[model samples]
Target: MSTRTDEVERYEHLWQEPAYPHRWVLWDTAGDVLVFDRETNCLVDFDDESVLPDVLGRMRAAGVPESGDYPGRPCA
Candidate 1:
C-alpha cells in the first residue's frame, strides 16, 4: 500500500553522490530500484521495469558502468 511519493520520501536519505565517474543503483527501504543521476544529484524512480534497460543504456552512454550493488548491500 505505498504510493510513488511515499516511496521517494522513504528512500530520500540513502541517495548519495556517485563515485567520481560512475552512476549507481540502490534500494529503498521497501526494496525498490532507484537510479542516481549525478548531474542532478538525485534519484529517479521508474514505474515500468521495462524501462530499466533504456535507462541503463543512457547512463552507460554518459559513461556510467553497470552497477549492481551499493557498498555492502545488493541493489534491488
Candidate 2:
C-alpha cells in the first residue's frame, strides 16, 4: 500500500496552477480522487471509501467545482 506522502509525491509532477485560487480537485490514473491545497502546499488522497463525500464537500467549500466533469478526467 502506498503511503499518503508517497501518493502525493507520485502526483506532484502533475501539479499546475489551479482554476481556483487555493484549491484543486483531480483524480489519479487509477481513478482515485485527490485534492491539492496551495495555501498549505498539501495534497490529500481520498482513498477511504467512507470519507469521499466529506472530502468532496470540503473541496467544494474551498471553491472547487462540484461537477464531475473537471478539466482532466483522469489526471495522472
Best by lDDT: 1
lDDT of 2 by residue, 26-56 (tens): 4343465656444444555444545555555
CA lDDT scores, all candidates in order:
0.48, 0.47
Q: Tell me the tens digit of each residue's lDDT in model 1 across 1-76.
A: 9764564444333233354644454423345445665445566666655655555444455554444444233334
TM-score of 2: 0.35
- Minimum summed lDDT over a 10-residue window in model 1 is located at 8-17
RMSD of 2: 9.2
Candidate No. with top TM-score: 2
